[model samples]
Structure formats: C-alpha cells, structure tokens
Target: MTGDHEPLPPGGRELPALDGGLPLIGHGIPFFRDPVGFLARVHSSRGEAVAFSLPGRRMASFCGPQANALILGLQDDTEVDRHLFYDPLLAPLLGPGVGLTAPSELMKWQHSLLLPLLRRDALTRHIPVMFDEVERYVAPWDGHGTFDLLAVMRDLSARIAACCLIGPRFGRTMGPALPRLLGRLEAALFAFAVIGPRGPLPHGLADRARETLVHAIKEIAPRDCPEGSERSHFEELMRATGPGGSSLDEDTAAALMVNWLFAAVPTTALAAWTGVLVLQHPQWLPVLRAEQEAAFADYPPTTLSALHKLERLSHCLLEAERLHPPIVVLPRPAARDLNIHGYRVPRGYVVCASPGLSHRLTSVFRRPEAFDPDRYLPDRAEHRTTPQALIGFGGGRHPCLGATLAQQTIKVIWSALLRAFDFELADPEVREARTTVMRLPRRPCTVRYRRRKR
Candidate 1:
C-alpha cells in the first residue's frame, strides 16, 4: 500500500537480497538464452519484483506495470550508467561522446539542435530525398526474385539516417563507405567477449573505420555557409564542442558519429524488419493495407501527415514493438539507497525494468501474446493506462530522443514499400536474431515483392 519510497521491512524477505540463477554466473545464461521464458518463471515464482545477480553484479528485476512506472520516473536522477555495458563494448570503436557518456550539458545542447531538424516541417522537406534514396536502393531488386530483407533494411535505415544527420550530398558521397565502417565497428563491439586483461587488441579495423568516418565528415563540412542558415547539427556539435569551444576534437567527433550509427541504424532497421514480418501474418496485412490506403486517399500520399494518418499501421507497429522490442533490458545502478515494494536496494546495486517481459503481461495488455493492434486503438486505449509499460523507447528524461523521428522514418519507408509492392515472407522459417544488446531479424529473411495491381 505504501509508495516506492516507503521504508523496507527489518529482516524479512523485504531486506536487500538476491534471487534466482546460479551462484556466480547468476541468471546471465538462462536470461540471455530465453529472456521472456526466464522472466516469466522468475515473476511467477517471486512476485512483482525479484532480486537476482549477474556474474559479479547484484540486481533486481521488476515485473509489474507499477515497477516500470517507478523506474522510468527516476530517469533524471539516474544518469545512464553506460560503463557497465555500452562503455566497455562501444568505447573501442566510438571513443566517447556518442551516447550517454557525453557531458550532460553538451548532450542537451546537441539534442536541442537536432530536435528542430527532425520536427514536422523538416520532415516535410526531407521526404522526397528519403523516398528517392529508397527507390534507388531498391531499384536493383527487380531482377532479384528473392533477397534478404534484413540486410536491405539495415542498409536503407543507415543511409537514411546518415542523410538526415548530415545532408543529402554528404550522405550520398559517403554512402558506399558506410557499410564497411559499420561492419568494422560491429566487429569491434562483438570482440568484447575476448577482450581480456591484456585489453582489446589494437583493433586496427575499428580504428580505420573511425578514420574513414572522420574523413567523410570533414569532406562534407559546409564549404560556404548559406546566408542566415546555421551549420548542420553534426557540424554545430563539432564547432561548439570541438577544440575551441567545448572542443570535442576529431577523435571524439568520429566516436560520436559512430555512436550516431549505433543509436539510429540498427534499432530503426530492427523495427522496420519486425514491422514487415508482423505484416506477413495473413490476417494482419489486409487490415493494415486498407488502413494505409484510406489514410492516403486525399493527402499527397507521401507526406509525414499522410504517414501519421495510418492509424492501424502505427498501431500494428506499436504491437510489434511490444512483442519484439529492439532493446529489451534497461539497466540502472542506484546512486543512493532506495526502497521498492518493501525491499531495500543498497547503493551501487543494478536494477532493471525489462520491456521485453513487462510488455507481455496480460494485466497491462489484453491478449498480450497475440498480435492485436486494436488493443492500442482509441477505443481500447490499453497502453494509456500505463504508458511506462510501453517502454520500447525507454521513459522519462532519457527517453530515446530520436523516437518520433525514428517512427516517422519507419512509417515513411513502410508507406512507400506497401504502396508500390505486394510483399510476403519468402522464407518459411523466418526468426528474429537475438543478442544481449540489440535485436534484429536473422539473416536470409527474403521478402517476395511484386508490383501492386491497381
């Protein structure tokens, strides 16, 4: 009955404790092997919030909707402790300023500059450019009967984000080199498992990738500033935070650019691929297509507003996000002592609110296992009851700043594809790729597309 701040019980089950999993490895193995199943077992047995450990760390898992609300609300107090995972993994490739590690004030300034560029007006100006790029990329598909949509979507999202982040000319010029840079960075991140006490091997490949990105960024630096118009967000960040101002320096900028890829590319690609796979379910496609057609009836058909009008399409995406979130577990280390649901959590303990498990709870979502978009429709309005439960974009102050822009980009791409082609899953056994970090569709996920008949 007490709020999250209420004092914990003296010595009962309410005391700071660890539950589930083995002694040292803790729950790391099973939790990664089958996250949903593991969390279900823990929640059913231990009640809403249960304590568990991972390797050298002690953490608590929160299962209920209330727990999600409580955790997300603390975003301001809890700066993202990137060191535990992101820092160690990504530091080799992306120096530092890319994500949560950037000095707080610099991040805020950069975000403010970036937000306006992703606003409705800016999106309107950029759709034609985005659509043009998509068309060029997909143009070769005519002769290719079957191709992995996963790779194609990844390439598409990365290129589009690059264009939006820099400018059309710069994005196009660097487009060919991007996939290589991304591959190198990904390899470095994957190499973390083997990065022993000797420390990560020189990582020459990752270093070269960073160099390539810096050269590309410098090549595209504004030749002559347009009258009255300021520099691009990336340029602004470099100038303000560069050697002179906050002076982030070239290596830092390269790292920040790599971080930009990490922040936007894979996650957006995953959402796009998942949206496609979800649409493959025979029952859902027709409804989604109809909704798309109706929404575009009077509008320019490619505008941001037109894409937003596809209520069912957006709902279907929300459902897909609920079912297969790109980032599953959000970990936070307590800065000070805290009490939650009668349990005391001491300082430095990690606590996680998993969208992967929480979104599947029937208490928060009706028929939580099924792909039912109507559950989020205005009439049902299930997500409204507990918005934090839908934490696909995280929550509170640190909520994914790129969320709206990501959604708008996804919707536009989906709209263009659906309008031009009829697509169905080419492989019978398509499955989602699972990693401790990001979720994506497994490779060789081919989609058969044909020109839609009028």
Candidate 2:
C-alpha cells in the first residue's frame, strides 16, 4: 500500500480523484448540474488540486491560491490551444485566425496591435459612442414595465460593442439587425460546442451571419478610415503590419473581427449581471445612484478622467465581476510533463481553473457568498492580498485585452440606467445564467423599472 508521504514511482504521483459518477459520462452529470459548486466541493474535500474525468477526456482542476497562481501567474509551462477544446464549434464561427487559434508568437502580435485600440486614451474617445448607444437602448425601458434582463442587456451590450468595435458606419448601416444577427451567431456557436457542429440545428446559420457581418465591415472599413491619417479602431486594425511589414488579407481581417466578437460580445452581455445583483441589494441602490448622480453632475462619464472617480460604482462592478465572471473556466494544456501539487500532469493534459470557484473561497473573501463591494475598498482590499484572486477578466498570458473597454461599457450602461430609472428584479427569484462556455445572469429574469421624477 502506498503511504501518503511515500515517494511515488515514475509517472505515478498522488492525485485525488473526485468520486460519484455514472458509466461513460464520468462526472459530467454533477458538473453540468452545478459547475461552480462541484469545483468548490472538489477543492474543499479533495484538496486544491484534483483530477476528474468527462466522457473520453481526462482533466485536472485547480483552485485556491497555489493553484490560482500556478495557472494565472503567466509563468507555468502551460499553453492554450483553444481550438483543441473549441475547434469543432468556435473555429467555424470565429474563423481560424490569430484570436481563435494562434501560436504564442502570433498571439503576441495580435495583442500588441489590438491592445492600443482598447487602451485608456482610445477607450475614452469611444465613450461618447458607447454612452450614446446605451442611452438609445435604455430610452425605451424608462416607463414602468418588466423587461427580460438577459435579452435587454444582450441587445444593449451588442449595440455598445458594435458601435465601439465595428465603427459607426457599419453600426448605422445595420441598425438593430446587427445585434440580433450577432446574437443568433453567438447562440449557434455555443450549441455547436455542446452538441456537435452537425448536431440538430440547421447548418450555415453561423456562416450566413459571418458573411453578412464581414461583407458590411469590408464595405465600411475603407470609408471609415481617414484619407491620410492613421485614426479609427478599424483603421488601426486594418493597417496592422505584421513581421516584414505585411498586412492582413481581407479574409484574415474579417476573421479577427469575428474573434474579437467572441471576446467582446459575451463578456459585455454578461456584465449586465452587475445590474441584476446590484438591484437585488437595496442597500447599495441609493449609494450607487447617489454616486452616479454626483459624479455626472459636473463631469460627464463620457471621458475616462471623470469615469475613474466613480469609486463606489467601480467597487460594485468589480464585485459583480468577481461573483459572475464572464468567462467561468480557463483551460490550459501542459506544455510538458510536470508535477503540480504532487500530481503528475502529463504533456497535453488539460488543466482548468474556474474563476467562479476561486472567487468564493472563504480564506480570500470575508463572506464569500455574500455580495460586498466594499471588500474591494482601500482598507479591506481582499483582492490586493492575492495576485490572482480577482480574475474578473482573466489573467496570465492571454488575459482579456478588451477588459478596459468592457468595464467602461458596463459603467456607461449602468450609469445611464441608474440616472434615469429606479429598478428591481421583477421575478425576485435569482438564478445563475445557464451557459455552456460563459457565465451570465439567467434569462426570464426580469427587472421592473420606472422613470425617476426629476
């Protein structure tokens, strides 16, 4: 019998295995039932690092500080080939571009080109467009009525993302149809991932959507570019000169936009959870509303300088991000065989970290389950205590480049909403959004809003 402290044999290390599963499916049932809870239980009972199986795949799960640092610290010998996990699904919709599936070198280049567009200065310039889009979307919801939270937010976020990323030309050209089409494409991609590409739904839905989007962008991209100046987000991306001064072809450029949609669309939509959770807490409503009013009284949130002063709002959004992380799980493949917390992680083995689970650790959060934005306050800053504890926008090598844009978009949307109306959950029965890849507030969840008397 092997003792707990005994030296293990080659290729044989101690890895706690999660029990209770039916034949063939392994832990699939329990995992699908409640992924966040299942992972939390694994960390509590089996330790921070453990192993689990799903159908034909062998996988490892990591949690707590040590595991968090290992996976998100950007130093581990782990690499991501998203196509390995999402190829059958995402590749067709997002395209085989650098954003979807790229080697380290190409990914680095893509980040370099894209990051500048999403930086503070550039993002500030786009704030007006974002704010205008949010105002347009929410203008209708002012009167008293219960609106589907996820659907409304999805449409709101889609308009904001489209305005900022795709430019006003394509945005104006497509109008509301853009968001609806993109939503359809996004749904198709998720379905493909779970149920195979050829599974159930009609073929070419995504292909058609992508064609429409690409065709519109290709037409407007040139006109949106200044005749001689290197301005506009789309212009910068189009002018991105690769190694040896080479530029992206039409197809590749379109593919990058598709990939950016994958990153920007869902994350922005999921950020609406901030509103869902915040409205549920009446204690924070007045506080948030007061802060938003005062902040925008003298200075419009259409600039980053003014937006940065909304500390309470920032805390609320950060807390919401911690609770409802857009991308719930990050999976990495071991670049080579290595020992991770006594487990022999073979090359190509899948190791995943769930920010959703990590955010709820009692050791890291005072009251992990409760929503306390003040936990991010200067004095009690829990996230500051650990490097990887607050992974709202992910971390490590492939951290979200559109993070600043996503946050600013959320801030603008919420600021506009809080200023215009008072709202609460219509159903009052909160539920986690059922999503295969991303984490979002569930639909059928409605918010009743009434226009505030000035």
Candidate 3:
C-alpha cells in the first residue's frame, strides 16, 4: 500500500470524495441536521478518510480512533491548521491572546500562564465557588414546578464562569447583568454551532457582546499585579507578562480572560447531557443517589476527598459524555498536502475527526448504543488500551483542557440537585437537540421537581 506521503502511486485510486446536490451548502444541511448520524453513515459506507465539498471549502473527515490519533494528535500547524478552523467564529468572542487566532509562539507562551489556572491546585479553590454559584442560581426554583433543564444548566454555567473564571469581583460588578451579557456571548456560539460555520453567522451580535465584555472587564481589571497568591483566574492573568516583563494592557487582559472562558469553561453541555441521560435511564437514579450519600458523608462533596468517593456517579457521567458529545466533529485545516491516516489530504482541506461518531462505534464500545455505566468500571474499561478510543473529550495530544473542570462541575451540580430535590422528566423521551456546540435536550425537555426532606 502507498504511504500517505507518497503521491497517488500511478494507478492508485484517488481518495473517495462526495459532493452534495446543493450549490452553496453541499452536505452542510445534512451535517447540521444530523451531524453524528450523517458522519457515521459516511464513514461506514466510504473509507475512513472521506472528503466533502462544503460551502466555502473542502473537508476531509478522518473517522475512528486511528484517525483521531492521527488528526487530533498533530502537535503543530506544520501539517494541519487549527488557527483557521474556528477563527471566524471564535475571534470576536475569544479575542486573541493565547488561542488559535493568535500567533503560534505567542499562544504557546501565553498558554504557559493560563493553563496553571485549570490545574488541580488552582481548580481546588474553584470547587467551592462552583457549589456556591449552583446554589445561588437554583435558589429561585420553586418547591414543585416544571422547568427547562437546558436553560437552568446554561444559566448555572454562566454564573460559574462569571465568578470562577472572570473572578468574584467581576461577578459582583456585573451583578444581575452578569449572566445576561454572558448569555449573549454563549448564544452567539450556539448559533454558530446549530447552523454549520459554513453557513451565515451572527457576527454582529457576537461583536457587540464582545465589545461590552471587553469594556466591562477593562474597567475593573488591573493592568498588572505583583506576582503572588491569586484569588481567581483573572488575578493570575493580571500577573502574566510577555518577554522582558511586558505587562498586559487592559483591553488585551480583558480579551484574554474572555478567551480563557472559551477554553476553561466547558459550557452547559456536559451537565445538561448528564441530567437528560440520568433521567432517561431511571435505573441509575438510586445508584447515583446512594453513591452521593456516601460521598457527601461528613463533608461537602465539593472537597476532593468527597468528590473522589463519588466514583459511580462519575462513571455514569462518563457514560453520558460518551453517548452525547457536545461537539460532533473537531476540524483543523490541512496546512499542505499531508498524509493523514494513510490518506492523501490536499492543502487547505478541513481535516475532521468526530468524537460523536467514534464514541458510538461498536468496535470501541460493547453494545455501543446501550446506556450502561458499568462499561466505565475499571474491570470493564472498554475505552482503555487504545490511543483515542474515547474521544468524547477530544482525547489524544489536543484533548479538551476544560474536561476536568467540566466533570467536577457536573458532579457538584448533581450532588446539590439530587440531594436537595427529586426531579423527574416531564417528557421522559427527551433526546439531544441538534447542535454542534451543545447537545441540549430538545425543547419541552421540562422536568418536574419537589423539595426533598433531608
């Protein structure tokens, strides 16, 4: 067999390509309508590496774990380009300090400062903040009523981002308006994901929201701070400096913090999916509650010790993430004619890998469609022993940085909710809404809840 680097050896068949019937939106409609289903069908029929003539550019989806390791594992932009993949959508909201939109070297340097904030030690402090934010956000919920699960989860996530990510000072400054403005930012992201980025986006709305964020953050954020113990992520960002102690300006500082939210906050998707899945599989309800009872014994589940004891709950959440991944596909533009997964991908083709598809492959998971949390148990770790078997969090070299934070946040949220009240889905048949950014439960995913006697 010819190598990916070698030219289509003489009579070697060209990489299989598919073109949709539409003009401007070739295959995008199907992709947006049912991303996982369509992508899986394509990979099942065609070869692992297949190309689609998308609206503006061509895209090559490298399916399965091997493709994930090959495509997502690309460290630098030498072969594949991440800087351009989400630039148009993320540039406005995330600004440009330590992200795909910034210069590679500058991004690398800035990442050094930003990443520590998401580490175990740094995140330990945020645990209490997440619990506090969830409590305050859910305080308004009545003793018994029907509510939109997705909306509640989204609001809670925004609240946590304001206090934990932007700092409590920023949260207090914005007060009631914190989530409103932050919602505007998330809404823009939702629009981009629901409709494929190849389609039109609400750039104007995102730009206005970002300007507001930059202004608000610049007003309260310090230009620089003496290196020392920090209270929140923003404080650490204020202390970060470039070569020769080049201090961060107010605007850049604000934008960098916002960018961190994009990287650090896992949005409402994980928690929301966990909720829907838990409700769908009522069999696990008592299991999770029993685990929580023990985990929260004597100490709040926010503590590391308590959190570790909630192993079964964590396994159930892992099952949810595997079933309903937030983003259907992770795409990076190929820098040049590169050999990817033994396929000749030409320059500028958007190289793609779908965790949404890989997670459900029967080859990777036994009875891939079944909602069995036991699969995550140590003895039956089906996702183990493979490089990228579980790509739900975009595993491999470029895994999701916010994955740990997201899992912790969800566990905390569940501990609080499942302890305080008993909830049942008003519509038990809740399925994932078709959005690439957040796999929210479809509309009318209402839940009935009542305060429980502790």
Clashes of each: 6, 0, 0
Q: Mind giving the per-residue lDDT tens digits that candidate 2 earns over 250-342?
A: 777767776665565655555677887787787898898777767775534666777887889889888888888866677776555556656
- Residues 1-454, candidate 3: write the lDDT tens digits: 1323332322323568875537866887787778888888888789677888655668888777777777776656666677666775677556754466777767666667667767877677777887877777678878788888877876677666666656666665666565566656666776764444443455666777778878887776542221234344555566677766776666776787777655423457778878888888888888988987776766454467778788888888888888887777788787777666567777788888888888988878999998888998889898885778877787655677677777877888888888788889887887767643555567767999998887
Write model 1 residue lDDT over 175-273, tens digit each, in one string: 757765675666565455234212445367667777778777766644422223466655565666422365656556555656666565545545555
Q: Output the lDDT of residue 362, model 1.
A: 85
lDDT of 1: 0.66
Better of 1 and 2 by lDDT: 2
Task: Please estimate how well model 2 matches the true structure, expressed as its whole-model Cα lDDT.
Answer: 0.71
Name the 10 consecutive residues with the lowest summed lDDT in model 2: 1-10
Sliding window of 10 residues with minimal summed lDDT for model 1: 193-202
Q: Per-residue error at 287 for model 1, in Å?
A: 3.1
TM-score ranking, best first: 3, 2, 1
